[model samples]
Target: MIKSMTGYGVANVENDRYIISAEIKTLNSKFLDFNLRSPRQFSDREIEIRGLVSGVLERGKVNLNIEFTAKSSTNLPVSINQELFETYFDTYKSMASRVGVNDSSDLFRLAIQAPNVVTTVSDKSDDQDEWEAVKKVVMEATQKCDEFRKDEGDTLYHKFKENLDVISKGLDEIQKEEPKRKERIKNRITNNFKDWMEENSFDENRFEQELIYYFEKLDITEEIVRLSTHLKYFDKTMSSSQSQGKKLGFISQEIGREINTIGSKANDAAIQRHVIIMKDELEKIKEQALNII
Candidate 1:
């Protein structure tokens, strides 16, 4: 299935003690790139996060963030910065002794104000349980992210098919004019040399040779055949059950190659108009391809 490079997905996992929320957003990019943001405790799990995303998405500017919220204060991990506590305690003691005052080391207020004194580090990377909770949330979020892409991809597929039909209809119109176009070219050539025709004394043999030479040089049958073949391959690629954004891109380039050649060689105003139309439709498809995965 085709996937769009732009999408949004979010999932939240809740347990008795914690709630884990993860979100993944992306935009179009030429290569696979992933940025992950998670709780500091799970900072060591960045590699695992990357691997999780790589397994599903192949290309995009992907950003993943997971937030962990402790559901209950009791479940919140707490740690003490003993060094900071001791500093505050001794200072209070020194001032109290110098003033001949008593000190009871009531340093709860000092400890509470100290940085890192109360931290979640104990829960972030402690071991088995923390990672297990994190992994559950991440995988759930990844699944949601994949689902989002698929849903958006379906919309892209519809647009692509619509454009393909437009291109095909234009090709049909161009084909109808092909015969009339050749006749018009012949008339123009004959009119230019009318004064030198048999009635006025022209050489029939040379005229025939010139006509054949130009016909051989200006024929667009091969180009049309190749373009049609490429179009068929393009349609087939679109219908395939795999990621073919890059492949479709290459096929469209080949379509352009043939269309351009036909335009250059045909030279008639009518055929040129069709060529321009083909080009416009192809350009639309090209732009649409950038969004597909």
Candidate 2:
């Protein structure tokens, strides 16, 4: 079945000390393009994460983000800069004495709230347990992404089928008009022959042979058969268990070629009109196929 290249998915996995969340978004592209964002602690896993996404997505522009939040107090290390705090306090005390101010009450509080005075330092240690948990979440998110693509693919499948049917119906109309088309062409050609016959005497056998050749040039039978075959093949490819975007594109091109040939060869106005409608439907199919993966 066909799969669309655009989708989104998210998953969260948590353990005692950490909660890892993964979010993935995809857009249609001719190749696999991965953009990843994660906490500095998990930077080492970027390569592995990309491999996982590329393996499943196959093709598209992928945005994968991972967020890790330490839920347990034991996992968080917050510290205050004691030396900086002391420096600020001494300066404040000196200024208060010089100004003959008796009050220095809020100096400690003000110093403690200074910029960069307090900060949390992450443990750079790569815990195997945490990495494993994050990996599982990544995989789960990717699975959900694939499911989204499959669901969108189902919608595209029906859309393509509907458009193909429209083209098929147009072909049916052309078939219905073919006999009348042939008679019109014959009458027109016969009138032309009658005018030529008045001008000069020509061999009847040669005239018959030349007329046959002209009729062959205008015959759309081969085009009709080839177009039908292409339509059938297009439908068959949708059921294949692999990516059929490129294949479907090629089939649509073939269908267009036959349609154009019929339009050029058709001498009947009704048949030409049917060919125009076929072209319109084929264009819609091509537009939808670009999003297939």
Candidate 3:
């Protein structure tokens, strides 16, 4: 089944020690473009995360964000290192005495901001279990995004089917009017030949041969055949079990070429009108196909 290139998904996973959340947003793009935001600790797995998104999404402009927070207090709060604070405070006091400044309100604030004076205790040990949980959450979010795409794809599929039907109807109208159009051309040509004969002597046999050749050139039988075949092929492509956005686009181009050729050779107002309707439907199909993947 086809999938749309636009979607949004989010998932959250939690454990006794941590809560992890992942969000992904996707937009249509010619190629896979991945942007990721996550805690620095997960930087080591950035490549793997990118690979996961690429493998699933295949192509799109994707923005992924992951956030983690402690589920329970485990001494991760920012606190002053007492020893470091005392050393900075002692230096500040000595400097204050030397500079003859008794006010120390700013000294305590400045000491607190000193390097290494404030810290967050970390369990620095690598946690494979935690990484696994985070990975599961990421995959969950990706799956949700895939589901969203599938839903959007259904809408696109219906739209494409409707337009295809309209184009097919237009082609049918053109086909139905073909005989009358050809008869008009022949009548016009015969009238022209009569005028020419009255004006100047010409070989009737030669004129007949040229007329036959001219009619053959103007005949849209082959174009109609090809156009019908293209339309059928396009319908078949849509029924396939996989995404074929680009392939369908190529087929649409071929359909357009045939329609344009017919319009050029039509020389009949009615047929030209049918061709215009076909062009309109084909344009809609082309525009919607861009969102498929």
Candidate 1, residue 181: the lDDT equals: 82
The lowest-lDDT stretch of 10 consecutive residues in candidate 1 is 103-112
Off by over 4 Å in 2: 74-125
- Give the better candidate number (2 or 3) by TM-score: 3
Clashing pairs in 2: none
TM-score for candidate 1, residues paired by index: 0.83
Q: lDDT tens string, model 3, 1-293?
A: 66789988999987678889999999988888899999877887899999888888888899999998876775545777989998998899899999899888889988989999998755342788888888899999999998899999888888888998988898889889999988898888778778778999888899899988988988999999999999999888887899888998899999999999999988789999989899999999888788888
RMSD of each: 3.8, 3.4, 2.3
- What is the lDDT of every predicted structure here? 0.81, 0.88, 0.88
lDDT of 2 by residue, 176-252 (tens): 88888888888988887797898899999998999899889989999999999999999999989986798898999
lDDT of 1 by residue, 1-293 (tens): 67788877787777797788888888888898899888887887799888877887778989999898776675435666778777877777777788786745455565457676666545446667867777777777777777888888888888777877776776777788889888998898888878667468657798799899999898888888888889889888888999788999999999989989988988878878878988998998899888878
Candidate 3, superposed: residue stretches over 4 Å from native = 77-81, 119-125
Better of 1 and 3 by lDDT: 3
Worst 10 residues of 2 by lDDT: 71-80
Q: Rank the candidates by lDDT, best first.
A: 2, 3, 1
